[model samples]
Target: MHQVAPDRSWPLFDVAATRRIEQAAQAALPPFTLMQRAGLATARLALAIAPHARRIWIACGPGNNGGDGLEAATHLAAWGKEAVVTLAGDPAALPADAKRAWERLRQAGLDLAPAPPHDCDLCIDALLGIGAARPLQGGLAAAAQAMAGVGRPVLAIDVPSGLHADTGAGLAVRATHTLALLTLKPGLFTAGGRDAAGQVWFDDLEVPAGPEAPCALLAGPPLAQPRLHASHKGSYGDVAVIGGAPGMAGAALLAASAALHAGAGRVYLAPLDPAAARLAPGLPELMLRDWSSLPLPSLAVACGCGGGTAVADVLPQVLPQAASLVLDADALNAVAAQADLQALLRARSQRSLPTVLTPHPLEAARLLGTSTPAVQADRLAAAQALAARYACVVVLKGSGTVIAAPGQPPAINPTGSARLATGGTGDVLAGWIAALLAHGLPAFEAGQAAVFRHGQLADRWPAGEPLVAGALAARAGG
Candidate 1:
């Protein structure tokens, strides 16, 4: 078993794929071998996490997940530890393998208890696993509440009860550590999963993954490419940032500054508000120019960071002309509002022009003609739908930023924290993606790399210092 971290990429399976893998493994192995492995792994990890604990409460449910708990309790009891077991369902109702496990538990001289021991050091939540399709009730609900109120470390088996293994929805058991058996799930790394499963660990039960493809990938850090000694500034290409109407000119300047710091060969600031030029003195490296003066066909453009209502006017020219484009914030809103611009945006894919759309949940909902709650309900589906609809790369920014492209598996970025909740961070990400695009990376790769880096910055931000957008933009390429 190994702990899940962001240092390496991991395949993320949905409920269907995990079920298939489990079935294949069970067919190839001896009867009850998988459950034995899972139980042993759980017992060992529990010991490792709480070595000195005398009392360990194991909450067992009606399914095989409960059997895993029963098997674990037997081991813990044999090891001279106080194993308190609670069964929420009848032993006779359990499946074949689970019935065998229950018999073993009885043979070990352990009996079911009425409720959790009040003084237990650690609680093992095995009430529900991936099969939790409904809300908690009865004994399961009481156990969940007890575990939550205990304020001690709770180790969950397979998955936290009530969380959708694929969608990451539901108010689930908040486990301090979740041991993913057989396969790593996508939900554990995204949405409410991160909060529900605090520290993720994986044990494949000695079974290899089946031929089934992963639904998504937990993205790792990008590989750093060494710059050639003889390379000049022009080798990186140019970036043009257009937006910043009236009072929001700082948004456009932030994008320009980010591109400059992120290694763009030349950064141009094309502000819609004429008075916005005065703000350029702070970032003198950015070349201030009129939006009409830019040669859109030759530049990588990041449009609509704080463009307000003015961004809609420029989409007609930007959609068809820019060599490559990253449409963000207001630009995404503009496309959602105008059917003609949406058609123009879609046409770019037909012409082999690379385009990426970075939309927060609200912007994504607007584009999909749905509510934010609906989009948030299934972020992977929302991102995939947007990518398919626009025929371009889509970066659905949220708790777990998702990057999806046509015909490619979506990637969930695992490197960010709540520090990135500040305003203008999205603008910074837009510029960072523009820089990568300017450096000649493909649209999907650019989005992935930039989002990874953007979140990584927040993850590594100094503890006491506030993580503001300007500082984040300045450190884009770091």
Candidate 2:
């Protein structure tokens, strides 16, 4: 078993694809071979997690998942550990493979009880696997509930019971560690999977997951590109940030600060509010200018961090003239509400100008004419739909932020945490992407790199340090 991390690329298969792989592998292998491998893998992980434990409680359901538990009990008993089992389903009503496993466990003289024993060092949750169509109820519910409060290390087989293998929804057992069988699941990394599964371990049951089309990819760490020794300030490129109306000048300045720190050759801040400060005392490198004075067609533009309603008026000029653009925050809202702006955004593709859209759940919902819940139910579909409809690279931000581009598979970012939930971090991300675009990366590549680095800063932040937006922006591209 291997731990999942962002340093390596991993293919993420949905439920349907994983099921096909399981069926194909079962057919090719000998009878009970997969079950034996699964049980052995589960037993080995349990021992490794709690080697000093004297008692192991294995909860078994009525399906094939139960069979894997039964197989594990036999091995644990042979290894001189006290392996106790609780059955939530009738033995006679079990599936064929499960029935065989039950007979084998019974023949091995292992103790099996109808209810969970009060005392056990560790709990192995084999109550449910990939297929959980309904909510847990009756004895299964009780077992799952008991596992949650057991105050010990819980090793879940395949997946935590009740979690939707594809969507990562539904109530699930809280496992301290999970062993994924056959293939890695997309749900385990996105949605509720991160909290429910804990540290995910992959066993694959010694079976190869064939070449099925994956729904998404677990994005890997970005490659390092060393700067040339002869580089100068002009060696990068110019970036213009247009936003910050009235009271929100800080938002535009945050983006400008981020662009400057992220290696933009020249950074210009064009605040819509006339009373905005002409210079940042702390970051004097940012050049403040009027919105109309900017040479839009000549430089990479990052628009709408705090533009508010004022951004709508400038979209007509910014959308058509900018050589490469990043439309974020209020600009996304403005485009979603106005058909004229939407048409102009779509027209950029015809001119072969690159554009990127960064929207949180609400902004994305506004663009799609749906609710935030609807957009979050299937983040990949929502992101891809937005990218396809607008003909631009889209970054749908939230837990496991998704980056989708037209004609490419979506990627779920593995970095980042709740520390980035502050107010102006999105603005910082916008400027970071704009800086990369100015440094000569494609829209998709720039978004991917910036988003990854943006989250990495939060992940590496000192534990006691408060992660504010300004600090986050300053820490980018390090």
Candidate 3:
């Protein structure tokens, strides 16, 4: 069993792939061996959670997920713990492995026809797994709901029953602790995954990954640190914010401020709105530069912060010269509309320059020539598709902000909340990521770290504290 952390990435597997892996694991091991391991692990976890409780309710389903619960009941009974196993299925119609587990539980004298004991401390939700593709209704759904209505903790097996393992969608079981078995699931970190599966724990069942490709990654821990004794203002590197045409100066300036606060030694703004040079009254440190005079390929460039229509004409130049770039906001909209500029942006791949594109659902839809619903349906896949098409790192913003590389397993950022839905937050994120890129972080890592930090700042911000876009920028890099 491996505990997921940031420095190490957990390999993700899809439902079909994971089942194949499970079968392969079973091929080498004895019959019902994996189930026994699962049961033992579940019991150990339950004991640790509610040691003094008088009654332990194990809600069993019709599938193998239920069989695992039955096996757990047998073990708990053997250990002299008060185990109550309730089943929602006929005993004769279980899958082969599950049938064997049920037989073993019956042989061990641990099967219950009625509902589990009501006076429970922690209910084990073994009702569903990846197999549940639709909304849970009827007896099982009602039982799961009844368990939820009780103000107690829940230990879900494998996944939170109803959640889609790949997309993290659907009606999900609200679990306090989830035992992620065999392989870490990608769904647990994205979409409704984080909310449904809380305080995740992994037990790979001593199974080897073998020669299979992972579907996603856990996004473990910060790979490196920024605070060093020898670091100086120049040591961290500089970032230049370009965009904020006319009315949207605050957007461009927000990125600049975020970059400055997020460990960039200095931040320069090259605003498209010339009249407002020396604007952003409160941010005295942001030095203004005209779009043409500012040095490119020297410092990191955060472009497209409210660039609007003006960004279209300048991409021909920015795409060629900017060595390290982050494209976001209306700039992506401009390139999506202009084929020549799209080709120019594509040319960045040949230059080997680092460019990151931050696009929300609609912007990503425009770039992909698809609809927003398609993008939202499978955010990781959409982001990966965009990254490969543009030959740049892509940050698909929304629930479960997916950070995808050109051809790699995407990382689903586990942090962030609805509070970040406010406007100008994306601008702040772009600047912070640019700052990380400027400070010598890889494009993908810079994006993931900046996103994690951006959300972390929001998560930790004190109550009554204003979480405005400007304030968000000010909280970056720390």
RMSD of each: 1.1, 1.7, 2.6
Q: Which residue segments of model 1 deviate by more than 4 Å?
A: none
lDDT of 3 by residue, 215-326 (tens): 8876655665648898788888788888888898888989999999988888888888877686554788877888787778787899999887887777788888886899
The lDDT ranking, best first, is 1, 2, 3
lDDT of 2 by residue, 1-478 (tens): 7888788878888889988998999899889998998898899999999999999999998798888999998899889889889889889999888888889998998657867878899999999988777999999999999987778888888888888777676789988999888888877776777778888888888777777888888888777757899999788899999999988898998998999999999999999888885545367788888889899987789999999899999899999999899999999999999999999999999898999999998999999999988887788889999999999999999888889999998888888999999999999999999999898899988988898889889999999999999999888788
- Considering every candidate listed, which one attains the maximal TM-score? 1
Candidate 2 structure, TM-score to reference: 0.96
Candidate 1: residue 83 lDDT (0-100) = 97
Q: Go through the candidates in order and give each one's C-alpha lDDT.
A: 0.92, 0.89, 0.84
lDDT of 1 by residue, 328-362 (tens): 99999999999999999999999988999999999
Q: Model 3: runs farther than 4 Å from truth?
A: 1-7, 115-119, 225-235, 463-466
> lDDT for model 1, on a 0 to 1 scale?
0.92
For model 2, the stretches where C-alpha displacement exceeds 4 angstroms are 277-281
TM values, all candidates: 0.98, 0.96, 0.91
Which residue pairs come into collision in candidate 1?
Answer: none
